[model samples]
Target: MGTREEIAFDRALGALIGGALGDAMGMPTQLLSPAEIKADYGFVDCFIDPAPEHPVSKGLKAGAVTDDTEQTLLMASVLLQSGDSFDHHAWVNALVAWEKDIKARGGYDLLGPSTKRAIDAINAGTPPEEAGRSGETNGAAMRIAPVGILVPPGEALIARVAESCRATHNTTLAISSAAAVASVISHGIDGADWREAIGFAVAAARAGEKQGHWVPGGTIAARIEWALDMVEGCSIEEGIARVFDRLGTAVISQESVPAAFAVLKLAKGDAWEAAVIAANLGGDTDTIGAIAGSMAGACAGYDRLPQDRIGGLVGIDLDDVRELARALVRARLTDEKARHG
Candidate 1:
């Protein structure tokens, strides 16, 4: 019987590994329309040779992760080095350093336009908050799960994560989207049920709404409510199909975030099912899989992941990620004990 600490560590490791696996597996087909993906690959279930023209294809075939996992691990390294505290300068410096490394490696040289602009602003001596423009890209939200794990749960942590998002994604929609996903991961670590996690995610979205970071009128909750109504009584396959058909697969936060949530709900608490469904959704498949995988990993714990898939992942620090996850858990527990003691 594993101890509670061992179980929690496993879950966190599962999430990290599962997230990277999903991302790498789906990278080759990312952003391809469903029809296009079908015509080219016929239900892609594993990482394949990238089309010659695909930017990530070369790296995908080599089992190298894209910016998604790279940025995530970068954040994790920063948090572990910082003893789980938020330091704006240190965070910004980390981002800069990672950006430089990615560029040097020619890996993320062709960065998302918004990310490039934000990084350029930072390089030009702009403050983190002022560095970002009003871009609603998923760049920020896609790599934000580490922040959720590092911070304690509450409005304060939520707000801090949202603000940290301003370093690259300052748009209201982008920030709100990041907060929604981050909140779900945080709630999952706290051992909240799926319903409660969804509720907390909605609350975090509302918190962003309150800060004028969401669309005016109804919030992410309203959108999720509408999405749920659309998929009510539908099969997971049907729901995923409908979302992919209607939303299309793009890297925009608004396009992929809700779709990820829809898949999460449809999975009915099965991490593998949720991740596989999200990964094959066509556009921005990697991002969708990453988001849903994070939630599912938190919900199911790492031990539930298939050892086969975990074994298939390459070009990353699996051991370091596991250690980092355990460290983050320790940091959280230490903080909680201090607060309650």
Candidate 2:
């Protein structure tokens, strides 16, 4: 492959694999307070299982991914199977099936509140389009990296993110946040620098926020802007403190999305550093780490991921992730070529 294509391939691999690595790295600390994480394991830098007292990830093994990576891979699978012509009904069905499998397997770290509510609605005979209308959490944004890598940076990409998110997170805030993440990933895969990529992400998020069905919440764009403002001239330590202390790491789209962006800003787009820093940030660590890690990984490419972490991921295989990334790149390239030709 040419240098350009090779770079895209590597970035794509980095986004997905680094995302999973970050997910696993933060598993133990997912529900812990920053103080609790500090008390239990000062500065989480390795894969560790959740503590017995942990609310969400308890009983999970070290390197076991939570819902974030699980849903990401599911989305990737559906995206691959559908090619460019995704069927929204099939996508919703896949989500329902995945949820059933998770419940059947006695998965403790089950779906997030927004996703769970949407799935429950589906189970209760609600139509697909209306099932997820009330979801305003970060669930859609957390698992949206595959969509980012699959689509280019444009209105079309934003629209796709909206469509993909509406089945489980239809709110303007949720769709906008998801679009921002996907746009960033798309820019990163296309070899854009962090600042440029983030710029595109911000713009796309604003545009997407205007398009989705309205729900009551602070807009993701405004929150991200506020987060960026908070870190404008602070030291890294201070920036981190500000993010964790004030920006928050909650499951809500407004909180987590901005928190992820704050960590990314603090880490200066270094995938490994971003992931580790995010994992250590306390609340909703895994999801924040996954989001930040995907962006950082896209910017830095796959080589930035730690070799040891890659080796430790429990159920996820790095090789498989790499192969999937390559396949996505090839398919996207083929589609782009066809469109241009």
Top candidate by TM-score:
2
Residue 18 of model 2: what lDDT?
Answer: 77
Q: Write the per-residue lDDT of candidate 2 for residues 1-341, one digit (tens) a residue.
A: 45867989999998998788778878888877888888988877777777887777777788888778888988888889886666667777787788778778777637788887887787788876787889998899999998888888888888888878877888889999999899989999999877778887678889888765798888788888898889887776687689988989998999999898888888888777777787788889899989998988887788766777777888776777777888888877887898899
Q: What is the C-alpha lDDT of each candidate?
A: 0.70, 0.83
Clashes of 2: 0
- Candidate 1, residue 270: Cα displacement in angstroms equals 2.7
Give lDDT tens digits, candidate 1, residues 1-341.
67656765666675676667667766777878777777777876665667777755554453445667777777777766765344556766777777788778766564566777877788799877776655577777677777677665688667767666766777677777778887877777766655677777766765665542343333555565555566667886688788877754577776777777787788776666766676567888877877777777776677777777667666687778887898877877777778889
**What alpha-carbon RMSD in Å does predicted model 1 have with respect to the real structure?**
2.5
Superposed by TM-score, candidate 2 places the C-alpha of residue 165 at a distance from the truth, in angstroms, of 0.8
TM-scores across all candidates? 0.90, 0.94
